[model samples]
Target: MSIILTVRRIDIEETLNTTPSVLPQIKMTAQLNEDRIWIDGCFDFVHHGHACAMLQARRTSNNKENSMLFCGVHNDAAIEYNKGTLPVMNAPERYAHARSIRWCSAVVEDAPYVTAPEWMDRFGCQYVIHGDDVTLDANGEDCYTIMRKMNRFKMVKRTYGVSTTDIIHRILTHNTLPSTDKDYFPTLDELEFCSKGVDGFSNHCYVFQDDLNNMLVRGGYDWDSTNSVLILGDFDLFHMGHIDQLKKIRNVLEPRRQIIIGVTSNESKEIIMTIKERVLSLLSCSFVDGVIIHPSKDTIENSSHDEKSKFSKVYNIDSPELVDGTVFSGYLTSRTIIARIETQRDMYVERNKRKGMPI
Candidate 1:
């Protein structure tokens, strides 16, 4: 789905009601039996590196199937106060980006600079995870010191190739950046601009397109030949039915075909697990080839097998521009389209036809 711009309403009552005292009362009641893995960072310009960290954190739990990853992206104020610079992506944008990541189960809104024990208790997180790279606060104190002393800290190896800081520097010095070093993926905004296509191009646009194509090649996605099918659903209690559906779709798979599953982040009144836990569940199912975080506009129905069975629709995207326009489109590897239909909202499954035809 294309990232549409919208004004997200904020709850004033919840905002003003979050006093320090209220923190204790806001604990995650569900997932008592499941392990919550906590990872916190600025996550300003989320990249492959951040995704790697989240993946590593999810693997730390003893029960891989029962583990949930909760990402705490520091708010804009916290970032500026601690790092002497505001994040390129504001708090909310960063939150959405983190939530959109398949590895992140849930994103904590406006996380504090310090990880309080109350936070650990509230989220039911047993361990605080971070990359091995050291990060100190403005006071020159290790940010994870408290957690480390309490024996609740574990570090994953940092991704070697790129970092957010490196991307920022590249953006600033794109004019003179070396050809061998041209490796940054375009942001959503940049991708949107590229979607305008070459017909809308000029000499300057060609230059930009060349750069984009370079990034796409480096990302190992062949934009021209890849075909993708988007499978939409909540996949909350990922079961045999879900796997069967994937198998049915794969039965009709063509060469170079990719399946993308969009899981609803829509809030549910009777939710048994956090969005993070639900994501982890779907991920464990071998049927899911890719996962997209779909923000639910309305309340989701309860987790009933009958209701889930209705999520058997397959969409044939007709527009090549929507599919191949942006590198971020389609499957994570590349080739893409913007399918706005809610993955769980409609049931347009064609029962007679087994495999999805390319539209």
Candidate 2:
């Protein structure tokens, strides 16, 4: 079966350029004819967990009618005031991340932690979706109580691994050494190992080098045999733009080809995210097959250079080389394509609804 990927685009320049204010206002769209599923939370560091929640929201729609997933992220002040700590990523950063996800159609800026009925009505929301986890306000009251009482809320099963807090803890305790057993670290905040083998790689981070090596040994993937696409970038503040680029690459390559991403750990003054954060973000995306961490700066700069290349010799061929009977080429997507993508996404959703299928 083929996977149907959803995509949404707000004004590209406006979304990128706008600075999210402390008390950002929500500008309601004039066209709210379709069924809208609303997901509200502080979507910081937009990981697999958040993506799964959006998917669940879409599934909950049941494809009976035209539906869109609108996410409402809590502003920085609300998060700090209630949770006693500020989010790792700021409001604008989080907004950009949310806007980039394919499943999310619209975002409600400066969303209140406790959503009101009027708020739901304002967005034409039939269901307000959230994870199974119960969230409490600063006053120790259930934030979603009102929605639950009104039967407008639905809870999706929370993903088992890699939370925003877990990433924060990893960053906070980045200097510690791995334990001898390597099952887990002794620190209060420890990264866990993937025990379920290669299949478990998506859910958890491999803490031990031996564990990862063991998976590689058991899986036995022939690197040179496969036609692979090598993507090299910092991938900081990973968003839909990054995913779109990867998707474009995937569309051109043969299905047998693997997509390996090289995330440079080289520090930059302008980068807001740490190297670990960047690596985890890249790993979370489904399009990526493998990630190379901390590649040498010199090697990354001269990847096309005719020298001792660590990449397989097949990819090391000179300019105008052909791999798997396909010529190596590049593309730069234009702004006009954004509108087409948005239109296509709408058509796809409508078609799925007509067929009684989930998108």
Question: Could you tell me the C-alpha RMSD of candidate 2 in Å?
Answer: 15.1
Across residues 119-208, which tens digit of lDDT does each residue of candidate 1 receive? 665666778888888888879898889989988788888766555544333233223232234332234333322222111121111111
Q: Each model's TM-score, in the order given?
A: 0.48, 0.51
The candidate scoring highest on lDDT is 2
In model 1, the runs with Cα more than 4 Å from the true position are 1-34, 175-227, 230-359
Instruction: List lDDT for all candidates, in order.
Output: 0.47, 0.52
lDDT of 2 by residue, 94-171 (tens): 776676454566677888988876666665676788889888998989899999998878888886554665443333
Q: Identify the runs in model 2 with alpha carbons over 4 angstroms from their true place.
A: 1-34, 175-229, 233-359
